[model samples]
Target: MRRVLLIQKAADKKDAKPEEIKKSFRTMGVTACQQMQGKKASDVEFLVSSKVGSSELLGIFENSFHLTNYENSHKKQPSEEEQEKDKEEEALDKDDRTKRINKKVDNFVVSTENTSVVEDQDYKFQQASARATEFARNLANARGSVATPEWMEHQIMDLLKKHEGKVGEVRVLQADELQKLGMNLFYNVGKGAISQPRCVIVHYEGNPEKKGEVEIALVGKGVTFDTGGLNLKPSGYMEDMYGDKGGSCAVLGALQ
Candidate 1:
């Protein structure tokens, strides 16, 4: 990294396009490797996992490679022959139509800002989606006793804590509490299991500036682990039965 820094500093690095920054880092890596090897580091010889897509690689490296090293035309002085060619090109650039078109093409500040906003939105979407999917998948693979109602409650609590003050209030009603309240559905379903039933109600007001309170609400049953109770599991039917709480997982992630 220090060697690459000594080679050339990438100016307006924060301004480089996603693709441009990626190629620059790859070049920087090869250059650093070549310096150590005392021989050319063939970029073509570079290997990557076949399972990962080019776009996926970019997404993985985006944060680390945020500061790019792009070449600046003004930093390096042009040779006499190159200067002469530039002079000819400058003379030919007197056409107003071409110059106007080129000026418009070069100015991309507004578009770039809009693009960054969209990219951030996309990144957030992917993050929340992954959270939901992972919760469901993990529950599916975990043992029936492991991914219990209490475990699911803890997961949702952790998620709320991670988001901090964004959420308003959270209430977890246990088996005895549900029975007292005359809410028998949740209690009955989870009663058969080792761990008692728990109903988690998360109250979140998404909008503050609006006239009224939260306009929308989501409710889901989080059946963390489901093994056939009295009727024992038969054959392939019992596999991944814990994933039945996908609805609840989706709700938890959507709170993001």
Candidate 2:
């Protein structure tokens, strides 16, 4: 059997010593771990065995998922200080009860073998959720002209129509149509491009009682990949330009 040992990055364990890590390998049942004499702790790589909690492991999975590269990422990895700052983000997200519930759900979904929960709808909806995430990920990661305003329009319409009963009033407006209504800024942005510009509108009648009244309007920008309009970016700086569509892609996924 092949064994895979996960070594925490040197940035995460800044205080670990090289010799100490090598010695700890013996207790971790990784006796074959090799160490070079001149290597620093940061350069040394070895698994530091620990019993990771469910929530902690889930956090690691989320971090890995978000860091996945679509175009063999040209950007440098986050620095130690940057990682710490991410950890320090505002905590007004939820209360303790919600966290406890999340931990329990995460643990159950990952490790439980309870067959009763394996119903048909569970499999179906889980697959749908997976597809939504994948769609959003791909759309946000698409580079170059692979995804454009008109292309995004088609995609949105296809998705909305796929679930026809749920979402209604789907339409695509051309550049001239948008300009007629005084959306010159949006119209001008895509008029020069060969693929042209399009505005996609989707409606969901969640509340039938208030049919005509609007409650929430979600906006997403499908920026032309890397071709910054008037102010162009350097070639190197334009990497992952498709990531600018993240906001809209997220809205699409949530709708899905």
Candidate 3:
């Protein structure tokens, strides 16, 4: 299920009065606006037609409200120092929440339509293990500077060793080795300023009957953080740079 914003546009092209906005929404077939009227909160959630895209809805709100008063009514602005502290605290809180969720184990089946993998194969255990492992990695990755390229390599290699009996063979290529072999895929940005990128491959043969047959190969991008590379990201955009390694962690989870 998806949540969306419902916006009401006033007919008069002037400062919005409460009654005018209600009438406009009622005309537009959004009855909830009248019911939710005069509610005040830092965050607001309301139902809207799936057809109404966020851009259009936000545009309507932008046009109807008195900009300064509307923004100030909800909350006051936080100082830069407060904002940074809040961001760090939020990341730590998320880490704790994920850890708690990972401890709970339950069996569930995923139903898919028109998928390449057979629907009846029933890899539920594998999927559960993968998801838990992924959450752990994601939490670790959320910590700033802890999910570097070298750190990612160590994590992946550790997972390979932890599941040694289940996995067939694991191979790792160090940064210098990768560079010498002309595989400079991840170092285009930050070049020698940061840790050299590394790659790890895990070959798992859960079934000995099909030893020589290969069904699928999955490649995961392991750029631990994207500082927009050499270009660099402006203020607001750089906060979530650590999420760039998501694909690699996902691959690591599946392999584990």
Candidate 4:
């Protein structure tokens, strides 16, 4: 026997037409002859076991109800003249900014020979530290996690490898393990969503040979998505929650 499940949100219940629902189910290759209603926001899972593979069923669900004509209907084609004008304006703006920056640089003066060796060394150290901090911040705020998806992990690892000397080694901890390790404070704030919270520990041992040297440990809070959890937040308050992982991004930027 084939089964079909229709899970609709309370907000969508009134607006969802029967034909649309049926069409969505049918598109998933499931015969929507019956449906069992459930509480709001929960997935309406269907136990479909047939000759059709689960992958196919999943594909149907994924593609079903996608706005087919909306993009085409809403798309506005720019005229050739409009496109040319935009390009010209962008080029002029870029030229103006470059000229302004060059003029500023020309006014800037540096007295390298007059400065003491200690001052020069301290300046270099400060610059290196700032670079590390920026790299760390950028990684923390970077979109997505290297834990859930292998492909993404590979990509991130490759990126880290590119900055091998600066980053050293990148370690991605499992969500459950990270929680057990008492890093839940950062992870728990953005739980209960499709995107899994991850704790990425980026190691940067710039000078490892010296014994008893204090290595700088820069940590950043990475929240993939902040829904304000059980506390609940006003719509406006939650608008900028996407940037909650900015601390981590800052760490990434510093490291870079």
Q: Compare the candidates by TM-score and give the number of the best one.
A: 2
Put the candidates in TM-score order, highest first.
2, 1, 3, 4
Query: Which scores better on lDDT, 1 or 4?
Result: 1
lDDT of each: 0.52, 0.53, 0.50, 0.44
lDDT of 1: 0.52
> TM per model?
0.48, 0.51, 0.46, 0.40
Which residue pairs of candidate 2 clash? none
| TM-score of candidate 2 against the unseen true structure | 0.51
Q: Which parts of model 4 have CA positions greater than 4 angstroms off?
A: 1-159, 165-170, 182-188, 226-232
How many Å off is the CA of 244 in candidate 2?
A: 2.1
lDDT-based ranking:
2, 1, 3, 4
Worst 10 residues of 1 by lDDT: 101-110
lDDT of 3 by residue, 117-175 (tens): 22222333333443455454554356446776767777777767767566776778775
| Backbone collisions counted per model | 0, 0, 0, 28
* TM-score of candidate 3 versus the correct structure, residues matched by position: 0.46
* Cα distance off (Å), candidate 3, residue 39: 24
Residue 141: error of model 4 in Å?
A: 7.8
lDDT, candidate 3, residue 254? 72
Model 3 Cα shift for residue 122 (angstroms): 3.7
* Candidate 2 per-residue C-alpha lDDT over 63-150 given as tens digits, one digit per residue, 9 for 90 to 100: 2222221223334676788656545542543333222111111111222233333243533454455557767877787765678776
